[model samples]
Target: MKNIETTLRNVGTVSLVGAGPGDPELLTIKAVKAIAAATVLLVDDLVSPAIVALAPPGARVIHVGKRGGCKSTPQAFIEKLMVMAAREGETVVRLKGGDPFIFGRGGEEVEHLRAQGITVQVINGITAGLAGITSLGAPLTHREHAHGVLFITGHVRPGDSDTDWRAIAATARDARLTLVIYMGVRGSAHIQEELLTGLPASTPVAVIQHVSLPDQRHALTSLGQLHSTIERDQLTSPCVIVVGDVVRGVAAARAPEALRRIA
Candidate 1:
């Protein structure tokens, strides 16, 4: 009777996989394998269709869009779906864009999944901050220019206090840290103002959009000109904002031949 009871209950695992940026080729081997084996996949809004095709034809794909400043699937509902799918013995893959831990709300998902007693795994991928900066022929940390880096998010939900950009600017200036801000386009005006309190108005800044994708575009300017640069170039969200001396000289970095450099 115990044997029969044990056999009657089937259990499955959940893998929280990062799809990297938009490039399908950037997916890790493990991520690819997990994706292919998924009987149920909950994909984020930004995941590339090309990567989604790695899954077999029979696998179920559910889009749970989560773009900033846009209507998105409720986080609670997405968590509930994960728990439901895993309990049904489906090989569940919660595919997110970029490294799951880097402002991807991956930590929240992991805690919720574990609380529900679902076995979970996480696979790392190159985050947009890293990829975006590199695409400009620049490095986040340079011995002479920057000693450390900070990856921050610019979005502040209603009722949430705004970030202390003045404080961050002071620290970044004194500590030689490079600032990589995500979802920051909307607040560029305010951020530029506060950052100028510590960082020089002439400090270098670059905004890179759709990093790692074919249509990627970036604008290089100074801290004082951040808002103007974005306005002039029509830069939008789903982008990263880089600031500090590390961006001072990227015009000579080796980039794809076709990429156009703008200021």
Candidate 2:
């Protein structure tokens, strides 16, 4: 090992890496490189264990759980830990699930680190909403079905104002867009009701759980039955909820197989 003073002076770098949607193979080559070079890793709860295991055997791994609606390690604390580790001249990696910029709080971490003059690099990974829908063979945006796609978080921060779902539903309906909601299972009923005011009750909806994993499961339902389907299927957190005409493609694609079996 290098001398402590030399190590401290040479080290001090932080990489904010996206671990992707629960698949180790989905990790970007740059992300893997950052992991391999890390002397300290600050891992988020949603990051897959397989990716975490890629860290060097001697790297210190710290779990900074940030799951929604659960007791979480405070963001400020996590930021402090990163600063501390990096300032000590250790190569640090803040591993988060999905693209750090997309609802991953990666921006905040980057801001905090930069404020303290720490050098930080970002490595992008596939987000769950994108990966989840594709896993079902549905495109997020199709020229014939959807004009665009919107990604939103289902949970509102505590003490903050709630999202105007009614307005969003109207916009989505008018824009012919696909809606992908993350961290939405708990408030699914309310979301379904508000969306119904704008979207047709027959609009296709898909709830994908454990997306891209070996045990992944999904359910297809209409807007009217979205809540009921989730409850009946016992779908829980870490699921992606997709709504809009893009889902029709999933049904249409499966129809041929279904008809063949029937025949």
Query: What lDDT would each prediction earn against the true structure?
Result: 0.89, 0.90
User: Residues 1-263, candidate 2, lDDT per residue (tens digit)?
Assistant: 46776855664999999999989999989999999999999999998889999999999999999998889999999999999998888999999999999999999999999998899999999999999989888899999889999999999888998888999999998999899999999999999999998988888888999888888998888888899999999999889999988887676678865323212
List TM-scores for all candidates, in order.
0.93, 0.93
Off by over 4 Å in 2: 1-11, 256-263
lDDT string for model 1 (1-263, tens) is 99666643766789999999889888999999999999999999888888889998999999999998789999999999999998888999999999999988999999999988889999998899999988888899999999999999898778999899989999999999999999999989998999999988878788999989999998888888899989999998789999987776575464533223333
lDDT of 1: 0.89
Worst 10 residues of 2 by lDDT: 254-263
Clashing pairs in 2: 12-89
Clashes (candidate 2): 1
Superposed by TM-score, candidate 1 places the C-alpha of residue 199 at a distance from the truth, in angstroms, of: 0.2
Candidate achieving the largest lDDT:
2
Count of clashing residue pairs in every prediction = 0, 1
